[model samples]
Every structure is written in structure tokens, then in C-alpha cells.
Target: MPRQHITTHIAILGCVCLGLLAYLFHLDQPVSVYAGTTSTAQDFDSPGSVSVVVNKQRPLGDPGYVPAVLIETGGISLRQEAAEAFAQMARDAEASGVAITAVSGFRTAESQARLHDAYTGRYGTEVAESISALPGQSEHQTGLAVDIGASGGECSLKACFEGTAPGAWAAANAQRYGFIIRYPAGAEHITGYAYEPWHLRYVGPDAAGKIHGAGITLEEYAGLYEPPSAPPSSAPGKNAVEPVP
Candidate 1:
């Protein structure tokens, strides 16, 4: 082969290698990390991220993960950012004559385990899994979830709450303040839980607004709603339950 031809071939090969490297680098990046994607606000995989998606299929990175800072709001504890947003939302609700109260928030993994155990004992593993979340899989452990209730405690945690003033108001307005109804009615298949009208998950105003506007769960919004490759196992003597929101 001519010397010039050999050099030209080598140059072409180098360019091809560079192009391949560039293509691989792009592939390694998260598609959602780019602007205009469904989730562009924050990291969805980090346990401490406001946009983190914690479902039965997607447990927290650390089973014992806790928020860096928690603040009390309406007698419940939430991460500082979530608490602040809730306070604002509460004030707004009260101003509108719809008093919102936080009945439960910021449960630890241990606390979740206790609740799960109690529910399992009463309802059996199958029913309990639908009503309650397992340890590490519960968003309440992230200090970004708050169970809202009426100030008068009417229909507090039951399905009836969705009809109450507080619940109705929050359903319509919580997204404006950076919260979403974590488990919506008729979405049990996607969220893995029954309708929890009182449960609100803070995902920042941007994400909350987008999710609310789209009428989808965080799992769907973050692209984590697919079935796991392997089914999750339960404790000895307990039947494996489906994933919960």
C-alpha cells in the first residue's frame, strides 16, 4: 500500500474510534438528565433527593436512610424543605377555609417494620401489603411524605377522606405547593397500593406540577414503574406482597 494511503486509513480509523467513544458516552448518560425530559428537576435515584421514587419495586439505596434534617409541621415531622412547603400549603388551605392537618410523616425503617408487622398480623401478608408499605420501601421514611387530614379529624385516613374539605382541597391544590397524592384512586396496579387520598409526597414544585398535570404516579413519571426482573421476597412465613407506592 502507498504510504499516503496507509496514513489516510489510519486517520479514518482514529475518527471512527472517536465516534464510537462518543456514542458510548452518550449511552451511559441518563436520558432524563437532559432538559425537556419528563424528569429534569432532580436526581430520582438518590434517597435524599426530593424527586426520589421509593416504591415496593424500588427500595431506598439504604434501608435505614434518613433525611439530613427534619422539622415538625402540624405535629408531624418532615424534611426541612418538605416541612416548609407543607407549612405554606397548610396556611393557604386554612385561608381558603379548608384546614389541612398532617397526621403522619417521617417514619423510620424500624417504625415502618412495626407497622408492616402489625398490619400483616391483622390482615395477613397479602392484604397488609396493599394497605401498608414495607421497611425501606415506604416513602414516609424519606421525610418527604405527609398524611394529611382535616383539622376536625373527619375521615382522617380512610377512603372517605377524599370527600372531606381538607382532602378535596389538597387534591386540587397540593401540586401548586410542590406535593402530589402519592397513591391516587384506581391506580393500585401502577402504584401497588389502595387510594391514599391523604398521602402527599413532596417532589419540588417543578416535578410536582408536571406529575400532577400529567396525572401519573411518581413511578410512572420517573420511568421506574416496570416490573422487577426478580420478585421480591418476604420474611419467613410471610407471603411475598406486590410492590406498594
Candidate 2:
């Protein structure tokens, strides 16, 4: 080979090698610090984010009353999957003689607006803002949340069902049937809602059990199931004791 040609080939090969090294270096770079702050379709673990968007498709059927005891009621109408899981839970609870009822379900955007307005009117916007999620942002909008209580209005969550027979029973058993307490009594900061013992979510048994066993929030579980590229922000209160449920 000609000397000049050999020199040119060597130069080209060096350039290619340098390019490959640069590419590898880029891939090895630390993950971005701002990963979870923005929305991205990649977050499959966060089913709530995907399901909460406003739409005409109400999962739980047209606005109507479902057997409350059978399901925890929430602002969103119950979705079919959620309703089914709740029914199973009700049956389980009934087997033990506790009658659970749903106090609320499926709130349309308009309904959420009214509810928020009502609470804000009474509690003031700032306080209500902390307690009440904005319409689209609410988990209730997904029709996956159920608020449970004793048959009579006499016992709201304040009844301490978490320790009572039914509450304790449900906590111990809900995971087997695909229902998980979405928020626990002391996990308010992680869940961004006050401790709502009555509220449960349907993430299926395996996930529910894992979360329940972990004693963390769905937010944290979702974060762990699909961790962000960067380190996590300080969680709301203390780190959640367990995941969802």
C-alpha cells in the first residue's frame, strides 16, 4: 500500500475509535436529576397518571350508586375492574359479618368542581387546596378509589377500622383479592391525602401484597417499581412505612 494511503486509513480508524469512546462515555454519564418532575409516557408503573386524564369513558359505568358495603366509594365512578375487586372484598367482609358501604363514587369534572368549591367555601381555598386535589389530579377521577365505612353513617373513618375487626380484617386480607388500602392512617404526607383508611385501590393481588408487605405508598411503590434516573426527593413526611395497601 502507498505510504500516504496507509497514513490516511490510520487517521480514519483513530477518528472512528474516538467517536465510539465518546458515545460510550455519554451512555455512562449520570442519570438526569430532573427525571420524575416532568410527565412522560414511559411511567407505566404510575397507572394513576395514565388513567386520570379527563375523558368521556367512565370506567365504572354511568353515574349511579353501587353497593357501598361491597365497594369503597370515591369521587370517580368505579371502574369495572375496581368494582369487581371491591365486590370480592365486600363478600370477604360480609363473610365475617361486617357490612361495608360506599359513600361516594365517580365524580365528573363538574362534580369535582362543585365539591372542591363547597369545601373551599367552608374551609378557605388554601386549606382546601392542601386537602382536596384538583379535579384532574385526583385519584378518584380514575374510578379506582373506594371509601369504605360501617353500614351506618355512625362510623366514618374516625371509627378506627384499622384496629377494629373489619378494618383489621380487610387490611390483612385485601391483598389476596387485589384490593389495597390506597392510603393508611399515618401516611398522609406520602399519599398527599389525609389518612383515609376507607380508601382502597385495585392493583391486583401480587402488586397489592408486595406493596402491603412493604408498607409504602403507591407513590413510593410506583417510584420504586420504576425508579427515576436520579435520586428521589425527600418524601412527604417520614418515609412511608410501607408501599400502598
C-alpha lDDT values of all predictions: 0.88, 0.60
Q: Return the TM-score for each candidate structure.
A: 0.77, 0.59
Task: Give the number of the best model, judged by TM-score.
Answer: 1
Stretches of candidate 1 off by over 4 Å are: 1-37, 226-245
Candidate 1 lDDT, 13-75, residue by residue in tens:
999999999988766765452123355445788988898888888899899998989999889
Give the clash count for each candidate: 0, 20
For residue 200, give model 1's deviation from the true position in Å: 0.3
Error of 2 at 128 (Å): 2.0
Tens digits of lDDT, candidate 2, 1-245: 99999999999999999999998877665532222322122233233432222112222232322223333333235777777777777787898787677766555556766888998999898767655566655556566666667666544655366656666677788888777787676765556567666666766665576667777665555552233368665576575565566
What does candidate 2 score in Cα RMSD to the true structure? Answer: 14.2
